[model samples]
Target: MTQPRAVYIHVPFCAHRCGYCDFTLIAGRDDLAGAYLDALQAEIERSPLTEPLDTLFLGGGTPTQLDEPHLQRLLDLLRSAFRFSPDIEFNVEANPDGLTDAKLDALANAGVKRLSLGVQSFDDRFLSVLERRHSSESAIEAFGRCRSRFPDVSLDLIFAVPGQTLADWQHDLQTAIALQPNQVSTYGLTFEKGTTFWTRREKGQLDQADDSLERSMYGAAMDQLAAAGFEHYEISSFARPGFRCRHNQVYWNGGEYLGFGPGAASFDGGVRWQNHRSTTTWIRKVLAGEDAIGDREQLDPEASAREHLILGLRQIEGLNVAAFETQTGFALEPLGGEALSRLQDQSLLELTDDTLRLTREGRFFYDTVAADLV
Candidate 1:
């Protein structure tokens, strides 16, 4: 197997947990930040990278939630622990509320090349509905700060909120485009099983956007972002030329990457594993020199092929048939079976001699398409 050239470090601290979030994170856990860093350093020390990494991602509940000193320590620890390619794409996820100037300076000085700001909406109404602490003005200010500090920045936007109209989503898109970010990621809101949103939805306290409205909102994003000269490179991602997010592309391409910290996941040599979700539990295990893994799965050839295809189709460029067969050692036709033909027949998929990609219609129904194939 080839050596992995990417790494992901999860920082599971946040000031407040959004009602819709189900990610592995603890709100009001800043007290544990120091120990978490210590455990993270130990985790990296145990399995140091053999080669300089091409890309690294610091993601979390909110990485910037740490104070300047702790944030600096986290950055310095990662830099000292691993060698980095001079042109490495180092990214950090940040929320608008607590992104202090000191934290921004620490990230910039530490060679963070990209910032993925969680600016869910520019509308204060939607922002409050989403339980985000930052206002539209504050988010815009944070974006300005990020732009000054990083060469490339990405804005994350969520649409199809319970009361969001198409015009409201369009306004948010326009707000993001006005900032001229290097990239943008747009996602429709989802009520995951364990999130507060789900319970509220079940109780009829919260209503989700209906299918037609959701579809229209998604279509508007595709049209508006594209018109603004952003390439719709992936289903939910738009990038200006030459600014695609390298770290996330690694995942979509099914490349191996090492992950550390609680709830972090790693994929290598056809095997995948995740660290424990509970931050305290993970810190304790790593400090005690025990494995922090919570789950592990080894995929056989067929399973791996299925996974590769699923991940590959996420990108607008789709899967290259010849390369998929060569890499997975399984023919796409046989692996995809009748479902492939059915999707094509439904005009939800497009298949040619060399590539297979989702149709514009399919992009909106991606979950359904994945379900059929999976």
Candidate 2:
């Protein structure tokens, strides 16, 4: 197998946890910042890098939440651990509130070339409901500042808010486009278990948008972004030509990557492992010179084949059936027979001579289609 070319570093600190977020993150506890960086460095040092990383992603809770010194220390450690490729795409996820000029400078100096800002929505009401700390204005300012430093910038937006109208969602899309970001990701709201939104919905305090309305909101996003000259490369991601997120593409394409930090996931040499989700436990284990991984799975051929099918379908361009078979040593026809037939009957999928891709309607219920195949 060739050396893995992607690296993912998870920084699991947040000023406050969002009501709907389920990603592994801790609220408050700024004191642990140094220790966390130290632990992260230790983990990176212990792991081997077989090649200069072509892509590196610093995702979070919010990577920008770390103070300048901590951020620098973390970056310094990464620089020491791996030789970054000359054309490497180093992406860091930032929340608007944490995107100070100093932090942005630190990121640039650390060789970060891309920024993914969590702009959630341009509407203050929706932002408040989502427990987002940054105002839309602040997000705009942050992106403006980032543009001066990073070559590529992406904004994340969520549609299908409870009580959100089509016009409101359209306005959000327009607002993001106005920012002129290199890329934008529009997502529908999902109520994950254990989230405040999930509990509220269970108590009848919150209601999800109707399925039809949500679909319309997604459609509006696609129409608007496509009009703005962004390529809808992935289902949720729209990018300018040549500005697609290479690190993310690695995951969607089933390429190998190494992840570090609490709740970070890694797949390399056909093995998948996830670090412990608890910050305290992760720090303690790493400090004790122990592997912080909690669960490890070596995917069997069939499971790996299934994962490729599921992940590949997420891309708007889909996957080549022949290439999929070669990767997994299993034919796609037999594995996806019933599911593919049903989706095709519904006019949700189209199979050309060698490729399979989603139609517009299929993209909307992609999860359902993917589940049937799995």
Candidate 3:
């Protein structure tokens, strides 16, 4: 088995939970920060990696939300846990609110090369609807601060709010592009099951944007961002030249990675597993010298092949035919040619001399194409 060269550490502490979020996170849980770090250290010690990591990502709840001392400790711990390649892409996720200047300084001094700021929107109204704690002014200010510190910074934007118009969504995109971020990710709001938004939507108290409007908003993002020199690298991600997110690309390209902390999933040796979703439970189990894993999945060869194809198509570069065969030991045609042929006829997929990728129309209907392939 090949050694994993990518790592993801989830910090599950947040000041407040958003109504639309269903991620594993504990709100108002600073008290557990110490114990969480202790458990995280112990987890790393238990299965230390032998290979130098090429990329390390600190994701969250909100990693930057940690107090200065705790945040420093977490960064130091991670830095020491692995032997990193000198060019490692060290990235961290942060929220705009409560990310003080001191905290930003701490991040810069810690060798973090990239920052993914959760600005969500530059519109105060949408921010309120999304239950974000930051105002539009503050988010822009925070982006400037982040840009000053990191060579590469990514902005997150959301569109298609219940009452949001196409013009409003375009304004948000314009605002983000004006900030000159190294990368941008745009997503349409979705009401996931078990979230407050979901319950409200079910009870008819909260309305979702119509499908056509949502599609238009997504289309606008692609057009506007592309015109501004951002490469539409993936369905939801864009990057300037030389600024693609390496950590996420690891997953999309089906490479192995190590994950730690609550609800963090690791893919290694063709088996994937996730730590306990509850932060407290993960801490207790690790402290008690027991396993913290709460779930595991071992994909069969056929299932794995399908997944590889699906994830590869998510990227605009699509799948290089020879490379896919070499890596998966499965010819593309036998595995998915019939389905690809059918999609090609509909102009939803394109099969070139040595690559297979989603066509412009196919990207919008990716779920349908993936369903057929699966």
In candidate 2, which residue ranges exceed 4 Å CA deviation?
Answer: none
- Predicted candidate 1 versus true structure: per-residue lDDT over 1-374, tens digit per residue: 46789999999999988989999999997999999999999999998787989999999999999998899999899889999999999999999998899999999999999999999999999999999999999999999999998999999999999899999999999999999999999999999998999999999999999989999999999999999999998989999999999898999888999999999999995999999999999999999999999999998988888888888889998999999899999998888899989999999899876999999988988877887776
**Clash pairs (backbone) in predicted model 1:** none
Give the Cα-based TM-score of candidate 1 against the true structure: 0.99
Q: Show where candidate 3 strays beyond 4 Å.
A: none
- Stronger candidate by lDDT (2 vs 3): 3
- Model 3 residue 159 CA deviation in Å: 0.8
- Which candidate achieves the best TM-score against the true structure? 1
Is candidate 1 or 2 superior in TM-score?
Answer: 1
Which candidate has the top score in lDDT? 1
lDDT of 1: 0.93
Q: Give Cα distance to truth, residue 353, candidate 3, Å.
A: 2.2
lDDT of 2 by residue, 55-143 (tens): 99999888989988888888888898999889999999999987789999988998999999999999998998888998988888888
How much is 193 displaced in model 2, in angstroms? 0.6
Location of the lowest summed lDDT over 10 successive residues in candidate 1: 365-374
Give lDDT tens digits, candidate 3, residues 293-338.
9999998887888889898999998989999888888888888868
